[model samples]
Target chain A: MAEIELPAGIMPDYRQQLPKFLKDYAGRWIGHAEVRPGVLKHWADDGQTCYTVRILLPPNGLLSAATVRRLAGWIRKYALTGRRTCRQSFELVGVAPDKIEELIAEVKASGLVVGGTGATWHQIKCCTSFVHCQNAAIDAPSIAKVLSDMLLALEEQKFPAPLKISVGGCPNQCGGGTDADIGITGVFRDPPQVDEEKLLAANEDIGLLISWCPTAAIRPKPLPEGMAVEINPARCVRCSSCAQVAPGGVSMGRERGAALSVGGQGGNSRGGPQMGAVIFPFLPAEPPDYALLKERVHSIIAYWLHEARPGEKIGSLAKRLGWGRFLAGVGVEDIESLIDDYYPARTVRRNLHFKF
Target chain B: MKAEWQELPLCRQLMQGLYPSHVAELSQTRYPLQMYEEGLKKGVSAYDYGGYISIPEIPSGAGVRTSRRPDILPESPYLRVLGPAGGWLSADTLERLADCAEKYGNGLIHLANGGTIELYAAREKLVPLVRELNSFGLDVGSTGDDLRCLTSCCGPARCDLALVDAPALATYLGQRFIDDQQYPGFPQKCKSAVAGCPNDCIRAMMQKDHSFIGVFRDLPVINNEEFKSWLAEGGDPERLVNGCPEKALKWDGHELFLDGDTCVRCMFCINNCPAIRPGRERGVAWVVGGKYGHRGPQGPMVGYVLVPFIPLTGEEGFVYLGDIFAAFLELWSEHGRRKERIGDFVARFGPRRILRALGLKAEPQILLWPKNNAFANKQGRRGGEGNGGN
Candidate 1:
């Protein structure tokens, strides 16, 4: 192939343009290490061999500008290009094997992990929780950091299969947690608090508030000054619609925590893929360690590790073993509270076992 | 035993050269074969063989046919291909896919109902065809039970009603969960989607097992100038004023004012009028348990508003959402019964229990039906509430 000449007065030097520390690490490979095969081999359009280096980002998918700049530097130094993988990792293509080690070392020096592939815990993914989100009830990154620390050691351990754990700061699981090996989401227990004064000031459109509520949780009460809306705490899901519709008139309550679900595997298997189900209704968000929450998760994983057959995903194993046995194996004491069959049995009568 | 339509010429024609030969032979021995033959002869498409073909007694991976069309001697079986999130494909990619379709399969490409692409190819050609497609950076999957493509509406990219970047979020999710799209290892298929705002052009809440709907945390921002201009352009002021579900809009002949407290932000007004727009404070509402199929217990249900909102901003936003998705997938995979959709699972186990396990407070918004006492008067309160009576 003929090389195309660039017509430029001055091309930006991205590598030399980097800071001294980043420049020093250029062309060096910082190995984060992978238990499973991380190398990807593909042919270019010209049929030339191309090598791509994959590196796992730390849990929560946050990367500093310095790290990104160094990555860019590495890409520039190697004359390679980069793209992000679906698993929240970066893949730098067109690197030779001779420079792989150095490149990995350089990336490591930049404080980024290099492995999140194969039959171990992958990079922990999360949504913006309390940090930047106005609707988040718990600090999602804090929980993710703790979980990452707990599971990162296992990234190198060969398990029955690869596992993905996703966390949503709130129930609106932007992280795709519903279809992972494990999913965690924050929750709010109380209804939004109604600022009667604000409601009065905002024109107290009581009828609008009542009609907008998905669940008829808001009711208009005659106030001495003007109309005020009262939330039926029993019926409120705390979806924040009222607050959205009437901004200053309503606000989220103080009570907040997290929820845990398990066995959500997405692959073409026996019955296609399945959405994860909640194993625990609610676990108080105990920061730093999150002891009780971690224990339950650990117990579920332990049971699956011991009992699951080869090539069996957590969802498939749960099905094969029966939900009752699976719950028992996980050391769940109140199984009845967690599992109920009446509703499903009554509703889906035709093609009950129909596979997609 | 039945002679009503057996002797008819239409029935004879229908029986002649039926694609699946076994059904032809079974006609002689089966009891209801005559009824099926009658229906087929009466112009009911042979593909509409619904009740006659029984579902498998046990859920098995084998013999699963995605399309209703039978493969004849020269025709190839159908293969499903997944489209990019929001069904947005670049022209170059489309050209490649079109070339692959023409070369590998019958000269046709189908956009499936689940927001995926389909190509009809010989069974033998599937592997190689997929390989060819892989070269173009596209893959075939979303057939069996697994996470299908994550769909979204054109957010700020094209539509003015959008509150958040729907396509960006969808693409983010598509890239983040690409493996799940290719692999089918769950009890059943799972669908997910994102909508830029409450307009929900993509029907995320009803068709997807997991849905993220864009929402505003504050009241809709009304541009007085735009409102006045709209009024001048023959925008029916009386209709707009009386159209508010909560009667929140007031028109003083020349100007319009919004009663923020009374507005429900259902997007009706915004949808109706071009001048009014959603507020600046935007985020996503996580709704779960939605599915279109009726095979599950909760037959064709709309998702429950699981979380009122989760703000999408920066890298932390993506991380927080990813973590939550992973956790729920694990929980459902561990306990959900065979062929149980997340919606049915939520219905059976109850959203409260699901929320409890996830450490979410059980709020009234998750309830499928309003409580009987929702409108009932409190014991200590008189009828003066909201009445504005002295």
Candidate 2:
């Protein structure tokens, strides 16, 4: 009579158990257990909350879900087994398209969301940086992690159009950072502003040091004034070219960061498929200093999202919009301060009817 | 109000959705389609040339979902069609699609990249409507990804830059291979586009999975006397020689001498020279994998030269290209992964791998021509010898 009958389809207070569930999963033999079913899942591996997912294959078949999730995930999971925070992807082998929705519901109920779809750049990929590659001129891994965090939100939201970004430590692109709407690479902004004391104290061997340059950009000298070696700076491609050959060859300018290039693609449109061009000389974006980089990327994305057609690539937009318009629109008044004119020696693209 | 897509009610949408099959399940449901039809019949067509639409502005969101309308019910009977280039046209097809909208249904034909005609119809009328359009040789369906219309260059009629006649090959091959104009299981969708001349006016460089373009080996020697007469009668020699990217031509006042080896045979000069001609021994050049979209380690690129196989004149040639493509499909579908276009598919196992997978030998002749950077001279040459090749 007191309406005690409707046993209250009350809110089942379940969120309170999240902490208990977390504690139980830790240090327990909850082996291969998935909280939610199919695709997305929240799991505890070695007592840490980890995100696991199932990727759907394209209509073209072959994929369990969509893309490099399994590929990128396998790289992170097996290759980076000890890391506390990890994202893992599993291929859903034999699932039908109609079942995707059903699996999505089960996964969402358990918590984690799927990765890389619609507008987001595929994944944050990095190659062995300066520590491993002979061709590496700078530290690419540090810059990659910085970029990954800087553009994390860009991964989930749908855009008026899709956008991509990449970062390369050296001229050889280890990180796809430079190919995106924005890119960053390591390079010196000026003649390595050296402390004369720092060079001499390092037992500078100028000859063997300079030999490390592929571009022969550095030249040593016996100067009367006290400047032992001066760099051409023009030929320097910002790879530890001179530093590896000569001791104290250069300090990464007075300030060190990464050089940025944009719109690298291999295509036969507007501009023939070619390497990305440098947009910023060097920005001091180590870890905490990503504010400027974030602002620069956000401004660019906001403009591009409004302007670009669905298939219009970033390179064409960068080219057609020119450095002047691009910089000006983004309110980057100090173009040189933002980027170095490494292209001064390059000539106008005179597409000779014939190539020699 | 060309086909009042928005006016069609939910019930009529379901009707049109069911109308295009052998079984007429929607025959009993006609009231809703009739209601939408009455509203669409009210618009007036005042313009003749420019339809309040251009290539880019044409409706792209059609057939985006099960219904022609995306936000509407998932099973709306609306249908949107795709065609070559989406807007790829021979001023004739452009005019015809435009006319169909003006006269019968709403003159709204949206073009698609893969090439084919897609029609939007009301549920009640879709049965009779499809049959009516079929009389004109138009088929309604999707034309992206797997199902596409075989594309061809406008060919010799408009361009002076083509090395061979692309239109003819496209017409011939299109007629032979793509009869049903429907999807069949293979490595993605098979794209066939022909470039009449080597200049590839039809974008064969970045289209068709299997592209056949023209190439010339020998230099086109000028009939000096005839060339001089044309020059005297106002032909530009600089335009003719400069047309060649190789700068393979030297006009020695009396004659035009072509540097035979430098003749990448881009037809710039041949197209420009009134007295010049295509060499008699000329033939078609075959290429594969010319898609230009997205990138990984290897991104989208223009077609690579497969083999400068001898020109095929009739049905035999179509069979040659088809068989070669079939071999490629067998290898790629079996080996390639998702998001891999043909080039990436080939690059994955290696170009040699692709060739071996297709049981093909690496023909040196295939490497004879560089596929990209196929250029053309923008000179306005009226009429001349393009067929004369040696």
Best by TM-score: 1
Candidate 1 chain A, which ten residues in sequence have the lowest lDDT sum?
A7-16
Candidate 2 per-residue C-alpha lDDT over B99-199 given as tens digits, one digit per residue, 9 for 90 to 100: 44334433233222244433333444454554444444444433333424455543332223344544445544544444223333443445666665564
After superposition, the stretches of candidate 2 with alpha carbons farther than 4 Å from their true spots are: A1-356, B1-62, B66-106, B122-128, B141-144, B156-165, B179-181, B238-243, B295-297, B368-390
In candidate 2 chain A, what residue range of length 10 has the lowest lDDT sum?
A80-89
Candidate 2 TM-score to native:
0.42
Q: lDDT (0-100) at residue B69 of candidate 2? A: 23
Instruction: Supply DockQ values for each candidate.
Output: 0.01, 0.01
**lDDT of each structure?**
0.57, 0.43
Off by over 4 Å in 1: A1-37, A43-48, A202-208, A266-270, A339-356, B1-390
Candidate 1 chain B — worst ten consecutive residues by lDDT sum? B49-58
lDDT of each residue in B1-390, candidate 1, tens digit only? 444554644334323321111122223321223433332332221222111111222111111222123331212255556555544433344455556665775444444345555565555666677667656566555645677777676344224556666656766666666666655677667888878777575657756898788888788777789777777766777766655657888888766788898776777566546567677777888888775332343444567787777787543576677667777776677667655678876666555556655666655544557655656332212333212111
Using lDDT as the measure, the top candidate is: 1
| Per-residue lDDT of model 2, residues A35-96, tens digit only | 33322222233544333334321111111111223233332322211110001112231223
DockQ-derived CAPRI band for the predicted complex in model 2? incorrect
Query: What fraction of the correct interface contacts does each predicted structure contain?
Result: 0.00, 0.00
